[model samples]
Target: MQNDIPVAVIISDNAEKEEDDKLPEHKKIVADWLTEEKRRYGSSLEKREREIIREFKEDPSGVRILIVVDKLLTGFDAPRNTFLYLAKQLRDHNLLQAIARVNRLFDGDEQHEAKVNGFIIDYSKNAKNLRDAMALFSNYDPEDIDRALLNTGEKIAELERIYQQLHGIFNTVRNRKDNEEYIRLLEEDVVKREIFYELVNKFIRQFSACGMIHDFARKFGEKKLARYQRELKKFVELKKIQKIKNAEEVDFSKYKDQIRRILDKYVSSEYVIELSEPLCLSETEAFNEFIEKAENGLSIKSKAEAIAAQTRRTISEQYHKDPEFYGKFSKKIEDLITQLKAARQEDLKALLDTAHDFQTQVQNYEDSDIPGELKGRKVYHPFYRSIVSIFSHYSVTSENICLVVTSLYDIIEKNKIVDWAGNIEVQRKVNLEMEDYLFDVVKEQKSIPLTIEEIESIMSSFWNLAVRNR
Candidate 1:
């Protein structure tokens, strides 16, 4: 009760035969627990059952233990239930159902390690009963059941193999203690980093399994187990840094917190890297602030990679915002990374400078590209660009293009009713107005050689762009 860990003693103590103090110590303890349970819910059987079950099912921290005789045996389903303490004897389907209580698959988010397997701690001497039931349950495949029910030794052996393979990733780093060298090796080879992620995940799963399988973990010995904890910690941190160094999405394992707890329990937490969500590079100030913070903690090379990853993602997402501008800087980032990887540009400062330059260009791109006449004209800007692009071969002045933007915008703005974009009649009116402006004003007077096909193409594109911008 003091621990604030809710325990549900789901037994009907409606009318006990003996007094609470007179009962045996264990039973008295249970009686005292039952008394609290009754107190909490106040003699309301329906409320008690519902509240207890609700807490146990929904709240991960609530109802850590449920002293159920058999109420939950059949219909109750809790995916988080990973352990079953057997104290009573049963046979066949009843035994199978009881064991199945813990057999439900469990998955965890970033706060918990996934429960890879269920555990049955038998105090009822039910091993023979379990095997007998499984064997005789003719509905189940004997071979399948045998494969699913792993004994302790098998789990330990599997853990050993996986742990060895996990450490094998960094075997090339001559100084096993040097984290930088390990990171450097991963930095050079992306494939090795991928392999490390997969193997480390398996190792965590296998290690988690061996650690939970009763007393069998003792066979790993104190020194060997300590070594495992240390190496696992090192690998987990390495995996974390590499993910950042490469600018991978923040898909850190749901099991990280649970694994961290396990490691912190056994080892020191000295070399841990904190994870922050990947920021949007389009949010220039936010991106700048985030990078400023990274500058304090991240290495020059890592900071560069982080910047590049973020910039590329933003360019992809905001490409529609300004494809011509975004694509230009996107190419610049690609070239810098290629040169760095090819050993042509080893200076990390150059990468930083390029990124800084890109930031300036993107922020000022609107000011420089949008003429003073069309300044603050958001819809007219793209329209003007489309005119400039479509009539690039002709000698059209910025003033003339601005006039075209005004004319086309007025036509679209006037006809844009509730569903004007989809309404073909509204579209035809817009296209005809645009065609008249493009031909009589631009082609006839300005002599830009704008043809029928070009006018139609411009109308379709400008209509779509207007639909989006407006």
Candidate 2:
């Protein structure tokens, strides 16, 4: 074993000679071999050679294989460890757990191929019939025993079927040559996009499994398998682009190498597309360039969506600063997208021009009629909008409404302490004071009488807005 592969053997020391003497002849021989092997390895005879096994498990560069009997099978997990030689007869959960030691998914650090699956060399012929071994768990479910393992051919067939299903979902798209057609088709129906995602995940899992099985290329012909892999890469790139355009999170570092393998082998280097870095919304020139590049690369529909998504994200982040201004932009962008989709604009150049114009408008937004007193005050903006929303129905002058709302805003701001929303006593006091001011002062001075229910409703809206913007 040492000549061909780096190997270590682990077994019980059975150091007590009198206790060893009482054991069976076979057991005594095994114990003696363990003791001699430990001496040969020049390891200290402390803790029954546990330290040596620990070193062996940790340092994969030094030890390529480990031979063990009745130890280190359970309570051991090493992602880099693959391949097990099972000589001992293990049954039930013991057998399942033993094989699982090597079944863990492992991605190689810069130097090695990933450990996709564990291989078992069954010298004792315990796993010759996997079904019989798994049959022991029939109490769990008899049918589950067969589902525990799938041969290479079955996995390949399932992958092919899933790939076909993905293509079938996009059958309405007539032009397969244009990549944008694929994106547009998916964008038109959210359900189809979701199904595509689900199928792609299933396909990837099976593709990774196929890497571990022997003679996969032969079972699933080399040319056909290569085509599937190339298509899978394309789908993955599309998904990445969609995620980025929507401001969705894209973290694939764990599966990066596995994906790279498919691209490196089957896909052409020149044809491979990488996801662009995230857009910096604060930089005007950089942002415009990003949108221009997106226009050139993606379809008209996708370009519109990408711009709209970024605009929406910007509005969400800056809404607290200027609620009324950003609110209008949000509504305008949403309306524009609805119109574009309804028209089905196919002229890419026209679409890009329209999108750029909208992007410019969003960047250069200015509030027209905001009172000069509330211009730079962030906290008062939401209060102003809330007031306009509530009192616009009544026949009252804008000046008088602003004056009364400003007073109400001042009262709420003064009483708000740490977590005032959560404090019932604080809320009760604030609500009563607001009611008194609105009914007594505003009703008498402004000649605008409000009912009890109206006062309560206005107070609720004011406090809620204050809490959100505070």
Candidate 3:
């Protein structure tokens, strides 16, 4: 309900009939509403209640909040429940049972929503009720009871502790202003990188949560708060740098809204993070400029790492555009990396040499190793590569390979039509043409010994690549 998400409210159909009470129709109305999703369901209300509860327990997007006057306050158990908003007054065992709803631990899910602790917002001024309930219903000491609940001031203290820990990692650098040094240290090892990511992400979440409190802003003051805002920006840029240098898929989905809140609250719009994406290989000047602008103290290995990461990223993203063509170069670069990693000697210079070659190759992919006849025919290159890949294991000579590729290209060019990739009719026609040519021309006329199964496999790859190319 906080961000336009739907909240679920469950009313017990099991409530005792109150003939003497006002609003006698309330229970039935609520029961009908519970099952009234989409339309009024014909199923039993209790079954529908269990279904919603199950959804809330398992799905991150399901049932953000629960409003219940009774029933569920007792037997309902969901470890994923992280927050409880109490409005009705209850004491002793009932209050204790309600408080226990959110006390369980959950070690994150696939959506990355982790629950280390629970929160309770007492709207009914339940301070006295909580203390009284503990004193009357529990067998615990006074100070022990006090430890169970904390004041809002503790949130500020926790935020400060996380901030200090996050900055403590960078204290080794004499020049704190040198962002490259901090990023390089993060890239030094995977553990440090993970710790940095965890701490900074926690800091941002804490800051976002506490910023809503008026006292938090007043306590930190304007200047100190501005400094923290800048720190958020710094963390964002460092994340971007690490992602590109490591070629990791960092999930920023969790912080999308929180980051927008932090930036929009500031006076200047200059604090915005506006970079398009990871540098694309096709854009030479921009990509080179990004690589050249690495941190000041980074070694030659770091530059090469950036190039390799970007090259891999480019191949992965653009592979679909021309899989047969990109597939060839992708294999070459990965083989080079595997070879470098497996080498007995640490020949980083050689690694750097290979990485630079891959970078240039990505930018000039169409210019190298193309068949003589397919040299100016860039549109036919991917198909030609597909043909080459299919016949690569055979003893077919280079001239014979070119001859097979151009013949298939002519067959495809003549049969292909508008939107040929999606049109089943066009694909069927192309497949027939390819199969006939492979059997009639490639098998009989050229004396190639390819099997029917091999011909089908090649045609399958071609059509798949054709769909992607489209």
Candidate 4:
């Protein structure tokens, strides 16, 4: 325990005498260390020992490190503490209490600023013991454990499917002469050959046990396994060929490079395109904005709620104008219904055509007043396309958008009228329903498990930095 890491042993003063005492050895070890320190320092030990221990117990600034063996874990509160290296085995309430010592809030800290890192040195073989230890302090719930296993299984299943597809493509390509020529060119290019090898090797290693590609060969069928090995060997041979110049050195190097290059080009254009895009700057900006609003104690959820209310108000106003304004709105509604019916059986492309026809009809109407100013705005075409595409292709319900938009349109119409005739009671009900639906969606998307205090601290820090430029 004391080879390189600094050591401290804290134990209950009355560990041997206490009625509930069960850890006598723990007390003895700590007591022995303290006595030795006392002897080494002589009479001077009396002055310094109590003060040093008390200050450590206090754990103020400049306490760079601490390595504990049982003692100070129980009722300790050290805000500056960062790491919790668990050398001793622990579980249940005792383990919970020990880890909690490092989780205390410190000054100028944004909630979880203290990094409670753990290093397990003893229970290396017992994975269950390590998991049980984690359950003491973290949210390692049973359901979470099941979900993690399910995700792992799904990943393995997906990888198995991809391997099968790749093998099918490889078999087809291997029979073709032109594909063989392509492989030759890839072999000639060192960079291209390396890329292809890495692509195969990464997937191979991901499924590999103990970092061995041989594990993949043993698990999958021999035919596909042989192909991977064959291709991989070709790649390595090409790498060697590129460096060789003389007749003896040239040997099989040129042949290997030529074969590998052909295979590399095929894999890239066919297989790699299907993978999901990595996070980009636009996504980062969206996330940063969200975090900023959270830190400022501002709620996008609440703003959306207010928008729902405004939408409802506009709908109420629009519904009040007699058969003149009302008639015009009803026409748009009829057109929407007609297009929706067309979209029901149509695919995305056909649905877009139907939406375009309806929009074109609206444009042709001599009575229309949708404003030329709104035409060709970047969002207008996209918004219309999204509406049509989602209605025709995706699973998201279009009723939510219609209910909110229609309600808002009605409210705007009502406000324009000198004398309103639409039923106020009906508008109120629609408004309430819209609010309920919008709030439910917001809650489903944004709800988190942190305490209110914790959330506020995180949001504040996030916004201060994120909104600084905005």
The whole-model lDDT of each prediction reads: 0.70, 0.67, 0.71, 0.38
Residue range 1-470, candidate 4, lDDT tens digits = 35553444443344335433454776666556666665876734445535545555454331235555446655566554545556556766666566566555332232212221222233323335536766765776766544422243444465566455434434534433343343444434666555544444434333331112224334556675456545544433332222211001112221222223323443453222211112122232332243234322322222222222222233334333222333454455455444543443334344444433433333332233322433433222222222223223334344443432344333334443332335465445544543443344322443322344433332232222222211
Colliding residue pairs in candidate 3:
none
Q: CA RMSD for every model?
A: 5.3, 7.7, 8.2, 22.7
Q: What is the lDDT of candidate 4?
A: 0.38
For model 1, the superposed segments whose C-alpha errors exceed 4 Å read: 9-64, 110-112, 139-153, 175-180, 187-191, 213-222, 265-302, 344-346, 359-368, 373-384, 406-449, 466-470
TM-score, per-candidate, Cα-based: 0.75, 0.65, 0.60, 0.23
RMSD of 3: 8.2
Write model 1 residue lDDT over 1-470, tens digit each, in one string: 54785666677663388876678888887777777776877865668898778887776667778878656778888777777888888888899898888887776664344777888887887867877897787666657766666677788888888877766767787976565677778777778878888887777777777777667557778888888887776677667666655555544455654465556566434323243233334566765565456423455565566567666766677666555667777897788667555443357777777766765665545535777788876657666766677766676777777887788888899888897878899988888888888888888888889878888877876888776655
Query: Model 1 misses residue 83 by how many Å?
Result: 1.6
Sliding window of 10 residues with minimal summed lDDT for model 4? 242-251
- Report how far residue 32 has shifted in candidate 3, in Å: 13
Worst 10 residues of 3 by lDDT: 269-278
lDDT of candidate 2 over 239-344, digit per residue (tens): 7665555645544444444566555656544443333233356454665455456433576667777777766777777675556668888887787677666665
- The candidate that wins on TM-score is 1
| Model 3 per-residue lDDT tens digits across residues 1-470 | 76888587676554335432543576556644554642554555666678778878877667767777677877789886877888777787888898899998765543434455677777787767878888887676788656666545777788889888878888887888776678777876688789888887787677766665546777777887788887887776687667666666555544554566665666343333343133444565565575567443345566667777778887988887677667777888787667655554467778888888888877666647776766887666777677675677677876787777677666666777777767888888888998998999888987888987889987887777667765
Q: Which residue pairs clash within candidate 1? A: 109-254
